[model samples]
Target chain A: MIPYSKEVLQHFNKPHNYGKMKNPDGVGEVGNIVCGDLMRLYIKVAKDKKGQEIIKDIKFETYGCLAAIASSSMLTDLVKGKTISEALDFDRKEIVEKLGGLPPVKIHCSVLAGDALIEAIHDYFNKNNKLIPEKLKLRHQQLQKEKQAIEERYKKDKAV
Target chain B: MKKVYLDYAATTPLDSEIKKAMLPYMDKEFGNASSLHSFGRMAKEAIEKARQQVAVFLNCRPDEIIFCGSATEADNLAILGAVKIAQKKGLKPHIITTAIEHSAVLEPFGQLEKEGVEVSYLSVGPEGIVRVGDIEKVLKPNTVLVSVMYANNEIGTIQPIAEIGTLLKKQSQKIIFHTDAVQAANYLGCDVQKLQVDLLTLSGHKIYGPKGAGVLFIRKGIAIEPMIYGGHQENGYRSGTENVAGVVGLGEAVGQIQKTKNEIQNIKRLRDELISNILQNISKTSLNGSREQRLPNNANISFAGAEGESILMALDQEGIAVSTGSACASGSLEPSHVLMALGLSPEKAHGSVRFTLGKYTTEQEIAYVLKVLPKVIERLRGISPVK
Candidate 1:
């Protein structure tokens, strides 16, 4: 049995933002075919009366396992109060850690959640004509390269 | 939160009696059957005794039984062995099997396909039993083996093995019939003569014995070649050091099942009651396979639209263990191929929960499950996107 932490189970049992927003500021979608786990992140980024850019609302729609649901719920909870920059800085490991560490098998699902959130934040910046931080962009590129390498390795193995 | 194990089809807990039967072999009586000494004689006698017990359970001669590592290896020996014999006779071999056979049978047939061996995967109807007519229709001049399973592992559907074997014997083609009786050996009445099959496979673990022990029953006159090459063992059929403890455990387990045959109906009734209670309490839920001709202990159901993993998780949290017809507890979330073959969509397949009853399952435990499962399904459904 997969050991989902109490916090993860609680959030998975009753997720925070479980539906679509009216018109989300930035929407990020991640498709995981290996496990058939799909997640969609809907972010509502706006300012209060003080004209400071703040996330007004964040919602998630996930069709996945407990780890996927909990990670999405935790992703929303972790990024709600943070600035766009801080939200972008949210790492996959931090999200996994926040859930008291998901099992090794399900770590990829948590990573998917983190990747989706960062993409959502980046989408928010892109739409607002704000430049994505150089570090996040570089990390994103690195992740893409790593994913490609893994896929290539799998293809080679399959060929053999 | 009471723990109840129903997935006995996947694997059964080792019975204490079988463990007791195996202990002496594992400790003081550990000796090679081929060795020339008192230790060897004791071990050899024990092995012969085990062979006799297994033969009695299957209603076959003691000489006909060959111990293998697992039923999978037994199946490989039977199918591949038959094909190689036919190939040597300058005949291009053809085989027939049901679409719903376990990977053990199907995967080997797949490998044989690469070697130009023609295979016909006969399809089962909505009832999930491969029709004898389908097998009749697919018979060829070179058909060497017709391999069918005694019972399906996923949906618990029992194939009409006796009828098929009887009909095949009348054909002039002389097709050597084989049935992978791994799932059906202990639970069902498996007499070799009544089934009229030349070969059959049985696994120990499925019937409350230690894992890694199985038997292959080859009728006295059947000719075959050994796939594994090594020192002569099991009359030069299966090669390797024998699993002495595992063999003793298997024999003991089979004996226990034989002694307890009267309790089969009671377990079936419990399974039926659990199915009836769940169906009566839950909404939009339906049984997956045939009702009348299924395993006595299986009740597979699909709760519409709700994710199976979430329900399984919720049930696990409540300490009631069950299995899904969808993804296994393994990391990947692929729905079960068995359900898909029955024409269920991936979504419907993902929603199927297989509640298999066992010897230790009680009415009160099932009642607890009947109470907790509906609430869990409702809760998961309430959170479901499709719902």
Candidate 2:
């Protein structure tokens, strides 16, 4: 068995931002079934007192392992109530640190959580016709490339 | 917390009676079997007695059983030893094995393949059962081995070992047939002559015995090279001082199986109940291997939307012990090669959980698992992104 941290187990046992969220501002679905991980994160964005957009609510539905789900759960907590910039700046490292630390092999789960956040923000920007950041564009391209690699590996495995 | 252990297929607890049988060897009677002293003779006597007991269990001669470190070593020695000797005889050797065999068996084949031996990994169907025709399909004139497992460790599907042995008998006597019977030794009676296997691997810990003991049944007249070298113990097939206590524990454990034969039926009953209740009560759940053709103690299932590790963690919190074949559950990123060989989707493979029952497993414990599992599955499904 992979030695999961207590926090990871707790979040996996009863994930906070779990379940399918209905009608969100943006939905970022990342990962794939073939790779054995998929995360669909939903966010509702509203303006604060200073007229700056802030995340009002967040939820996630993950089809993955314990670390994946826990990472997704932790992502929601860290990004909620933050402005768009703050949410994008939310480090995958912070997610790992807050979770007490995941097994080295499962660190990909945290990277995946960050990727889903970027995808969600990209979706949010796409929805409002806002200008996309170059960083977001680069990450989006990277995600697509990673997805193809996963699919290619899957095909090779199936062939085997 | 109400703790329940249901992972006997992984390894079983040491049986107390077997422990008592090993105690004297570990304490007062401790000695090197190779020494000329009386203590050494006593240890040698115990070692020889253990060998005799294992021989009786397998229905082979006492000299045929070679005590090894573990089943992994037995498997390595059996495959590498047999294949290497065949190669040494100046014949280009070809070997056949199922894709779903334990890594122990497969790794040696890989090693042989690197040494220019033609190796065929026959794929099993969705039921995780390898067919005899598949072996015949790949049977080359120079084929030296047909090393399929007696039963799978993950899915617990029993292969047609005796039938394969029979087929090999028709083909040629030159071809050595081996089976890793580690998972089947507890529930199934292994008569080496009846099975017609030239080599068979057995482990102690998988049964109610100590962890360190293992046996390789080398049918007499099958000359093979040794994997280890030093003290020339285990008939020089394996070297170094004998694991005296482990051999005694294994002997006592194998002996206990005959007396506890009826307990197999009880274990099957509990397994059936656990399997039935989980399949019936949990929606979107499916059994992974052949429902009827599996080991009496095994019930491997997949919950569609819930990943295996998530479900395992939930069950762990509930104080139940089980094992999962999910990629995430394993330290590696790769999912179970056994489940994947069955052509299950990666999702299903990542969700597979094996619940193996033991002699000590009771109906009440099965009921408790049935009670907790449905809720766990529902919770995970509720959180799952997959529809």
TM-scores, each model vs. reference: 0.86, 0.98
Name the runs in model 2 displaced over 4 angstroms.
Answer: none
Model 1 lDDT tens row, B155-228 = 89999999999889989978899999888876788899999999999999998999999899999999988999
List the lowest-lDDT window of 10 residues for candidate 2 chain B.
B326-335
Model 1 alpha-carbon miss at residue B261, Å: 1.9
Q: What is candidate 2's TM-score for chain B alone? A: 0.98
* DockQ-based CAPRI category assigned to the predicted complex of candidate 2: medium
Off by over 4 Å in 1: A2-10, A19-42, A48-52, A82-94, A100-108, A111-160, B328-333
What is the per-residue lDDT of model 2 for residues B1-387, given as tens digits with 9 covering 90 to 100?
A: 888999998889998889999999988998999999999999999999998889999999999999999999999999888877987888788888999999999998998899888999999999999989888899999998889899899989999988998899898547899999999998787999888999999999998999988999999988777889888898899998999999999999888889878898898888888888888878878899898888999999998998888788889889899999888776666789999888888888888899998988988898899889888888888988886
